[model samples]
Target: PVGGELASHQWRTEHFNNPWLLGAAVLVRDETAINYNWGYNAPAPGVAAENFSVRWTGSVYFGLNTEYTFYATSDDGVRVWIDGGLLIDRWQDQSATTVSAKRYLTEGTHPVIVEYYDRTGPAVIQFWWEPGAPPSPPSVQPFEIIVDDQDPGFQKAGPTSSWYFRSVGYKGHTYWTYNSDAQLYNSAKWFPQLPQAGNYQVYAFVPKQRADTKNARYRIYHSGQEHSYSIDQSIYFDKWVSLGTYYFAANSTEYVYLDDITGEPYASKKIGFDAVKFVSTAQPGPAVTPAPPPVTPVTPTPTCSIAPILGFGQVWNTNPTVRQRLGCPTQAEISTWSAEETFIGGYMFWRGDLRLIYAVYNNGTWQSFVDNWDEGQMESDPAIVPPAGRYQPKRGFGKVWREQAGVRDKLSWATAEERGLQASWQAYNGGLMLWTQTLGVFVLYNDGTWIQP
Candidate 1:
């Protein structure tokens, strides 16, 4: 602890302006998550960052046993140690600069300590670590692709592989649960190529089939990474089941696999494979800012409107008993996704913390898509989170926001609305979490399901 005294000496200043090594004395300290940006001020208001000294000690958890490099970027003198050994020892006055040291450790916890001193001027400190070596050259190019029913990119396996992803009605065999059926094999694999690099969402045709397999396993591989997914082929039917979105480097060899060897205990059941559809998702692209026009642009009044919601709209706006219970829309109604196959327009209404989405039935009645106990959102939640909308693009299966895209050529009627719906969504993964004034948090899934998570 005697080193704490040297912290105040100019010889031990962050810049190391003096060649002499002065002793340091640790005076006061605080804990942090290693992310801080304080400019032209002390770490604490009264304490001067100049000649201020701090020491941070903690344990870093590593999931995998691998070599890691601890990096520290600071504007003053700093020292880092792992275990009982020193990795970096530049305890001298310095301007904004970064220094790092590598350490070999097992897949577990390791002790770490960071000592820093701010001599003067702006103060900045940051620390971070990642698996494997530091970031290097870019690897493969990500890809965007679409494999349709008729597209040659589609492939099947196993002796029992059906002709394609089809429902029973295609052949009028109502006996089949989903009207159509596709077959699968153990370790069955399909390879589809992409035209370029980017992130893409993989959706599988899931038609309800009571007799279908309960634990059909599927895996999607992209950009040197793969994720496993399992489905109860009986529950979700007549819908595009998402296998999750992933990034893929441009390559014709990338594949999606359906394997029978799942770790779970199940029978030797027959799995179905409608078709795997891929649609381009968000990918990093260059950004450019353009000069503003000489004249000020006029703003247009935003129009609020909902697509024709059939019977549901009439009751949502007129029903007496329902209005007394759930209340009516606080603001104007918003258009929501309508099913292309059913030709039903959906409506979203918000009355304070009471939020509801409505769809119609054959008997001209309206009902909520999902039902459950309640939770509310926090006051800090975004005013509007993108609602689930279904759109089927002509080129691919189409896009469906979980509770959350770009405008495309054609869309299934379900989520049709005026431009700019995507701009309001704050969810990164299609699931929106809203903070309500009363309830803590309410979640809306991309498939139009609600839960109080």
Candidate 2:
């Protein structure tokens, strides 16, 4: 479609600066493209100049499985979703900023959504897409099956004394029980549904908090035999502790079991049962890819090297490739978000050449992107893919963000990126997503209900 459907563009006013599309649309019309600079003017006849939102939904046809980067530049906040997956999410009050995310799409039509909100400034928003490198052909991809504590394959037996604890567990949650004798009061089992009989490497996830049992025992029922192993959960935190490879048939009878019996004086230590993973060791088939059709070649833009900065010594010194990707420090780190009106907490770093940026809280957890500049970025290798154009939380906040699929699906994809913040907290879709040492990662919903998982 050359022009968008008139019914797809919707404009609605939000008196409270709430970016969500809670009310009915006040203005609905067609738009050729999402390129606008309202410049302190109202977006539409009835829409307000500030504290208003617009949503554009339509189907986009993709011609290849190649990578495409969607760019969204807006003032205030903006979010974009492709095929219902959130790519760029920078739902915060700021100047005109551009954020982008890359997605590999097949040759077909995919649903695209763009949501924007202007708080109180020169409204500016432009959205477009650029094709990037094509995806590699399927190769010897590792075969792995992960069964989280919340998965259907996981079961808890014995006493109901085991409790759910929110931490940096495998899938952001774990079941814990006080250590006891081998009598077994609480036990958890993970049954694997394999595709075919083969050798698999099994591993267990140990969380960082509330897990202190030194002699946490595990039992693997496979090949009609029982294999026992003891683990010291206290030594490793938020890590996958391997339990060696084993042979298993594709049946429900074989399982991995763990009990709260470590013989370490009852109630003295906590035993954590998180998630289990099974990895196939089978060799992959041969790789085959047809030749791509020849197309007109264009000269690539040359990228320059980044010069070091005094303040970014820590991150710059560690990652050598950051210099190449980001040409130079455009300016010193500046305040992004603040705790008090005067106390700077969130800081941002800009690059001189491309539309890339890096941000960090006072804790030094960094976030980088080719366009988006919120949240966390941890990889150091240049070859290691950057967010490419996404916002991912870090540490505990990341744990909760990864676990809450339903919340993210509702708030991130279905609505605008107008997450508000209040008093040392970040808000999202009428819910609070903040982290603390005492409370860990939690979400406080508008209904006064709290969830930590």
Candidate 3:
């Protein structure tokens, strides 16, 4: 008996029984088999050649309490019976196909009878079942961060002559603007040598502005060939969006260029670009709890938001084709959430949960890793606008906290209620904890309270 929560069941049966025997003279081939030429010559008189009979016993006792999946290359037919009960009679002239059915039977030895005929070409019948529990669905490898830039070194592709500069920003590190004419085509290249050819996605901090078709456009290039795509900024103000994605072939150099550069009145207003990040199409290795080490004390750097270290409690999901074709484990269950990606030195310290899975492309190569986050914990609603200097967390549970030398540290933690006016706090020198709230900005003290400056 195929076990589980009894998802569903179907039964059908058909019989082609003739009430009249046609042409009685049956030639015995081996005393066990007889060849009766019913359609042609030498049938005794009064023998009917064609006839049909019907009997509804309601069921057949074939005792075949097993589930079966039938496949036919050209044409096929099947008649099944269980415990002498006629269940399925699906005999029809059809093309090659596949069908499945589940049957229940008594314990011990159960009888099963299946009459399958392949009419045209390739024919096959196979059955497999989970005797007790249903098999678990396949998993996808976790997503991983392929290329990252901390500062200084990460630069944008220059004009037809100069490349964009990577600069430090109030949030973290960002790319500088192109001083060249907007109409003039320019690009910024990361120059990171990719491991293989796969689906690759590019992320960057782009200054937001009003929608103008003639304004700046974003494009990616692999092996010097322009990839087809554009960013949509109709819904956002001046903020960051995952510029979208493109394909990168193996052993190829990739770069992103901004074209149709317009909106000068707006471009001159902003100084530099945002952070640029590139990740591979491969899944990240399993999450390993890093060994504890001494906390390195350092001055608190200004942070846009805090990022939390995630645990196994997180889950995710992605396109099935990405999972099956590219060997990416679907984030369908907890056991499969293994890979991780950490975005450091940015406006927000974010991490991608599934870094091990890669999506397969139509060209047989796998695409870059597509991070799938926990829907309930992480923000999945694409419509939710991000606040100033804040972009979407890569994936998984996001925690806003302070870190000192890669170790999690608290900078005077306080409850949401204690952050209001009636709060008194002590001051500690060199402990930089700048807290910016909706109303205004303030600093935190060792006593776990806020003091507005």
Candidate 4:
């Protein structure tokens, strides 16, 4: 058999091991062969030897129609696809290891893509292929099972009207549809029946026709965990795309799922529902124990604690109105309330029994009820009319005036309606009282000193 080399451009990056080949590339070069051993050193001037990634894409020529096995070896993660069919998918961090997958193809040129990343330590990667079936011993061939869309093992759900069938390619027939706007509106599941428990590489067949969705979502339920993957069906046709390998028990709980929801625009593309193949990599038999199931992560429930208060004691002991409205402190006192005030020492309190919240300002120990329900109505209500020569507080001023008896006595009577000084508010009379979010509520006396009521 004649041999041919691939004309490829390798895109390399110094960033951390990224299986997706994302981010900018640090080096790009056309190489005649896919072979490299940049051990403990950068492959290029700017690229890092470890914690880096590389992607090679090009076309390979096959002189004859036959079975060909593609091989890849890497220290960490790696994935390979030929003519849009993912053959090798060991995309994970691991020591130096090699993996290969064989596929039959006609005489022609086919596109190939290889992606690799090194996490740490010595870095290495190589790719090559031989024209022949993978050398297997005289032992029984590994067990392999494929569940077609028409098979009883293949279950489907959705409106019957949306389901359409086609007869062609690998499985003889497959189900396909236009992309759906609704989530998971159409779905198919492939449940395989294994004779024994073991690890298996799963693959989904993307048919030649009626499959055009760029984002086809597949889920594999194995060993109490569901792994998700998004495949572009438009690039693959009449080929089994690897969905990764997993440990599965010979039971009904493990299966493969495909849905119409691909986050694509409404009815813009076609989606194909076809067959799923499970190739057993582990030894088959009752004597082979199933791999331990992955540990389901446990999320810790959140908890909160209220620290003891020391600064609010002074204000609580001094003001009876604050003590009555605020009750016991819920949180500790802090210096300089927020970013606005210059005063030190303030605290927030809550009456759990009454469901009332209160706050006292540090400047003058002014009390404030933090009631959300009645605050809007109380502040916007009409002002009370003045009695004879005495004037009533206006707008928000009236609401505050009516609530505090001490304000009425100290201010005598309002001479005018509340006016705004930027974001602050004030009313005139025997004494001027200003209200601002930062100062809370306080009376500015003739001597310039303010008092909290």
Give the top-scoring candidate (lDDT): 4
The TM-score of candidate 3 is 0.28
lDDT of 1 by residue, 340-407 (tens): 22221222322211122222221111222211113452322244343345333221112121221211
In the range 116-193, model 3's lDDT, one tens digit per residue, is: 433333333322233322223224332423232344434444453433433343254444443334455444444446
The CA lDDT at 161 in model 2 is: 43
* Of 1 and 2, the candidate ranking higher by lDDT: 2
Per TM-score, the best of the predicted structures is 4
lDDT per residue as tens, model 2, 41-80: 9887777888888877655566664556678889989877
Model 3 gets an lDDT of 0.31
How would you encode candidate 4's per-residue C-alpha lDDT over 1-453 as one tens digit per residue? 125232343322223334455666667766666677888987777777667888776546666445667788888888875543345778888888988765554444555667788888878788877776323432445878989888899999889999888896465898887777666678888999977777777888999999998767788787665655556788897988866566678899999988888656788998888989888764343211112212211121122132213323444355453333333322333222121222112222222221222222222222322122334465443445554544554433444446643333323343333333322222121112334454464432211122354
Minimum summed lDDT over a 10-residue window in model 3 is located at: 308-317
Which residues of candidate 3, in runs, are more than 4 Å off? Answer: 1-183, 195-200, 207-216, 222-226, 233-240, 243-252, 261-273, 281-453
C-alpha RMSD of candidate 2: 17.3
lDDT of each: 0.42, 0.54, 0.31, 0.56
- State in Å the error of residue 368, model 2: 52
Please give the clash total of every predicted structure, in order. 51, 3, 63, 0
lDDT computed for candidate 4: 0.56
